[model samples]
Target: MCSLLLVYISVYFCILLFIEFLLPFPSQNRRHNQQINQKSSNFFFVFQISFMPKKMKSRYILLTLSIVIAIIAILASQTLFSTPPRVFIHNPFDILYGIKAISYSAITSVCSHHHHHHHRRKPSHSKKKISICGDFPKNIPPPDTDTTSYLCVDKNGCCNFTTVQSAVDAIGNFSERRNVIWINSGMYYEKVAIPKTKPNITLQGQGFETTSIAWNDTAYSANGTFYCASVQVFGSQFLAKNISFMNVAPIPKPGDVGAQAVAIRI
Candidate 1:
């Protein structure tokens, strides 16, 4: 029995060895395909390291680097040189305001004015636009000719209103033009303001005697206080002659109630 068992075991061992070496029907083909795939993969790997970079690879790398740098630079600029976006406006009126402010400041810097220099004469060739203010001596006649006629007010006859300020309001409403308003002899008792719309307006008085626009108002005072000026002229090309502004305040102290009285503002 022992001899028989030993022979059987040897046969079993031989069978197992044969099965281990034997490939399955499909697995036989798979082995050959796997060899080919391995060979191909190795070849491509070598080729990539050797001759695969024949097409502009260096230039491509450089371009990619430059793009990355540009992105970084843009990000850096956001932190380093960031500024508020400018506001753009297309209004025609605003254009005039911005440019005129800068231009006038530049011009006025070169020309200084003082009290003694108030009575400067106009050019010889230029035409005279005369306006009379205050109460004339009742002897001078108002000019009828058109040359000096347009800019003068109350030139036709004596002022009908109780005060010259009433006449100013009437003129401002009657016409928006800058024609002169000549004030004939009168002690005007009121506060007035020549609006900015009335450009090129001029005021002439009868040597500040009969013709006078006097109001008692001040800066610190309330809106309608005597501290405010009797008349405030804002329009440009403003010319005043023989006009004397007086404070009608009963007090005479420095900061008196009538401390503010602007006779004429050009």
Candidate 2:
């Protein structure tokens, strides 16, 4: 509403400027300075008003009011509809723990490098040190014998399918049997969908931190909000555990059209 008002006001002032400065005016009397109407061939009438001292005060007042209103509208719109900043409060203990761990790692690395001068130190230790800061789970659990009709998906090609979408597509549609899909720990960057025809399906992941599915489709790009999800599930009796769905698209500002990006739609 405020935006429309601003645009209307802007266009009005532009027209006012054109009429005041751009239009030609032929003075009938120098002293009288009368207002006159000029008609063009297209039957369009233009009004020419003499610049009097009394009208100058009103014009100034109108200009000042328009400027003030525009500023107020801008500020009000920002205050009402602007997105709030995301705030993260970290635990002080976690900070101290991280600092201590880094310090210990540096000291141990220096000592190990100095003592093992004759021997060539392997680069594996550096990788291990890097893993200390990583929070994702590394271990992939073995599947239980509860569900015989099961498929496995792993990004490392150690399973039945390398992609989650492929595993879902391979499932028998409209199955009465409960099918389980075990996703190994790794990030899968793809959009997944389970149609209504495929029911009684359960998706199991190693852990939420390690097993994450991500896509970057927005509503505008996908044509609608219904099609923009990273994962869309329409199957009955569907279940997902230890899995994270993520839409890695950038955050849209207020007033952005078709900017809705969904993580999961069931």
Candidate 3:
């Protein structure tokens, strides 16, 4: 709009100059021509003074518009290209709420993972449909019972074997018939293992409170929970009755965490 107005003003000035040049000046009268030329020069001077304020005002308005356009362009570019600040929930009382939130999330994730691992390690409970122990021959005398099927273990050497594992070893790979080994009342500190080849074996004790098998292997002792068990049974149709299996590993100290040490594994 300003450019169009300037063009119009320039055209009007050119028309005025052309009309002044084309006017008749009475060329035969020299003194009259001089007076007419003096009047025309005075009229052009007054016209220039009267239009000076309007020309200055147009220039000032153009300058102001140019400055405003430049400021608007700069603001638009910043709005388009600048990055926005991240959004968050702020608590007036907790200045470190963001850090605390991150730490709490991490702790919760770790605890959930540990809980799943512990659940997987837990033993399952399933009822057996077939009884592993059937009825024994009642007519056989107590002292003259079949030696191949029945054995006894006593720490004082009053029975067939002195140790429980030695009695188990005596029945090597016997799977045709069920065998029973009775353990006397005593605290046996031993690691006992029943191999898969020796199936259908029963380990009997005098009583649960009187008989116990214990060991002290732990994860720190280079044995994991599965291997650190006091009693491990791998034989099928194997049964243990009236006995307590125990792992005597030390308890963890204050502010310390340790791996699991199992008492029994089957």
Candidate 4:
């Protein structure tokens, strides 16, 4: 806007200067011609400056130039000062609080949407310990007997093991029977491996939204791309349901060496 205004002012001054050069002083024309021309138009009052003395014409030009320059200066100052300043946040607590607030809002929105659609899952009320735990499982217990096929894993110590890897290690090698591992809703932050010797393994979780296995291992840190996976399964007939595997490593920069991160390698 400031640029456009400046352009218009410049054009106006240019037109004024052109008109001053084109029109001759009234006194230089013959009396008869001046009288006839003046009588031909009633708009001569608007162009009366064309008949002004040299001193007055110079003063008019100076005044117009001064006004245009003043306008330009004011517009430049307004354009420079009108921008809003940027602010940087330095408080860790504020940052954390903001993050928590955002997460809470998102969860609330998801819950409200589910409620509106009548698709919200209810809590499990089954008596059997091996039954599927609903989304966001809490206080779920492990199987009382060792003969059961399912081994429960929870982060709250209510199950057989706190870590998923421990449950995988408990499986018998070369067993003909299948082992079903029931994982409750919680974050498991360790690397999990199902060796080739442990075949026919099945992993079940409460829900993908609540059950997650995450690690921050990159290829450079873990020594290789194969070892950087948060979960690795080499066993045959292995199946996983309602679970999430995440590699939380930062994205590698361009030309970065050995920065590949894998979430799951099967």
Candidate 5:
């Protein structure tokens, strides 16, 4: 009986040892649990890397896009609305601020800029103009001594008009292109108005005293406003020589005295 009991104990111990070994490495359930745990950890790792939310990074991307679009819109507007440029300048600064285009006639029409420049453009041909008055001006004389004198003298001859008004009436008929008006010695009384379009005009007098334009010294003379003269010159290149402009008839009163009788409208 003792021998039988010993064999039984040995068999029981062997069977328990076999079952423990199977549970460690050979059991399908244990291997399946290990595989499930590995798959769950891998899923968590992948989700953290791919679906992580970052508000700051998203805001940065959106801001960058917005800035780029704004810059594009501004540049496009300047191109569409701004005037065309006169010169074909590849200015480096234009890279920062888009440049506009313009035409020559438009640019020349406006005399607004203090210092104008041209880049990669052809030079414009400057036009020249002048006026020379002769004795027999197609117009009337400025004024006459007892109705026998003249004022505006041209290349032709002195235009002796009864009144200065008649002389001015015919000025438009005269053409003085880069010419000099040779005025003969005479007390010609008249006021003149020259426009700037007629450039390079030379108004030469026969003599300073003889070629005199006399208007009332004051604005309250005979013709209240037309006391002496009301001449306006708006020419670019103008020349006046040997001409005496006087408003010194202020004997007792001063009407248009201090004012400039001979006005020069450059």
Candidate 6:
């Protein structure tokens, strides 16, 4: 009976040890699950704190840059389009007003220079008048006069040159004598320029209503106002008679603004 009691106590001690071990395993598994959940939460929190704020900051910077660029563009456009058109003076009387404001010595020098130039040009003036009207015995010749000159332009190829600009080009630069260009009655679509080097040129056309030079260019075009002229005369003692200059460029519409398109600039 003592041996039986000893076995019973041993079995009871073994069962108690097994129960304690099983309870500890369950608690350890619970703690491991809690640690894994904490690590996952920390990862998500770090992602939100680090990456989200950076993304937001980048967006804000881009938006700020876009606004600044838009503002600059608006201001620039306003400044450019709001500016007034430029005016140029071509009248001799208007130019004289500015010249008269100069010092006495400057005026004296200019007067002396002009007097010398006038004296030198006096003899040529009579020759020019004779060359122009000498052959026309009548005050006004017929519509088509037989009188000819150094250069003549006829759209139908009846004269030496087919175009007015070709006739002017034939005269070349620095002509001492009066070079006359006779243009027949026709609509000459051309851009004619007599450079400063070419002097003492006379352009005689048929009646003003009969002879015409037309071009399609505006100051707002690729070439500015100074260069957009249908006919530009820069030569000294240059003359144009019985010729109509016209700019065929479309006029500005209502509510639209642009620079002036000049028909002629002398």
Clashes of each: 30, 0, 0, 0, 27, 0
> Which ranking of candidates, highest lDDT first?
4, 2, 3, 6, 1, 5
lDDT of 1 by residue, 1-266 (tens): 22233345545555554564363435555665466556567576444434323232343444455455445335424423322222114442452454465457656754545423653643465776665544345533354354333323353354444455555565543344445566665566666677766665667776777677676555545355432666677766667778777766545567455344444444
What overall lDDT goes with each candidate model? 0.52, 0.72, 0.66, 0.74, 0.46, 0.66
> Model 5 over residues 1-266: C-alpha lDDT tens digits?
22233345545555655564455543545555466556567587444333323532343445455455455445434534342332214552453343333334345546534234343254646755443443243434343344222345432343344333344443443344443444555644555656545444556676787765554433444334343354445655567788766655545545534443432224
Best-to-worst order by TM-score is: 2, 4, 3, 6, 1, 5
Q: Report the poorest 10 consecutive residues by lDDT, candidate 4.
A: 79-88
lDDT of 3: 0.66
Compared with the true structure, what per-residue lDDT tens digits does model 2 show for residues 1-266?
A: 53446657866865685466454434433233332222223343222223333444455556667677576446535633332221112542343454455567778989988879846654555454544315533333344455447788878676669899999999887987788888888889999999999998888987899899999999999999999999999999999999999999999998999889999999
Clashes of 3: 0
Model 5: worst 10 consecutive residues (lDDT sum)? 79-88
User: To one decimal, what is the Cα RMSD in angstroms of model 5 from the true structure?
Assistant: 26.7
Scored against the true structure, residue 8 in model 5 reaches a CA lDDT of 53
Model 3: worst 10 consecutive residues (lDDT sum) = 80-89
- What shift in Å separates residue 187 of candidate 2 from its native position after superposition? 1.1
TM-score of each: 0.36, 0.46, 0.44, 0.45, 0.30, 0.44
Off by more than 4 A, model 2: 1-147
- TM-score result, candidate 2: 0.46
Instruction: Give the alpha carbon lDDT tens digit for every residue of 91-180 in model 6.
Output: 424323433443455778889999999998775544444343234324222243343235677777666688988888888578677777
**Candidate 1 vs candidate 6: which has greater lDDT?**
6
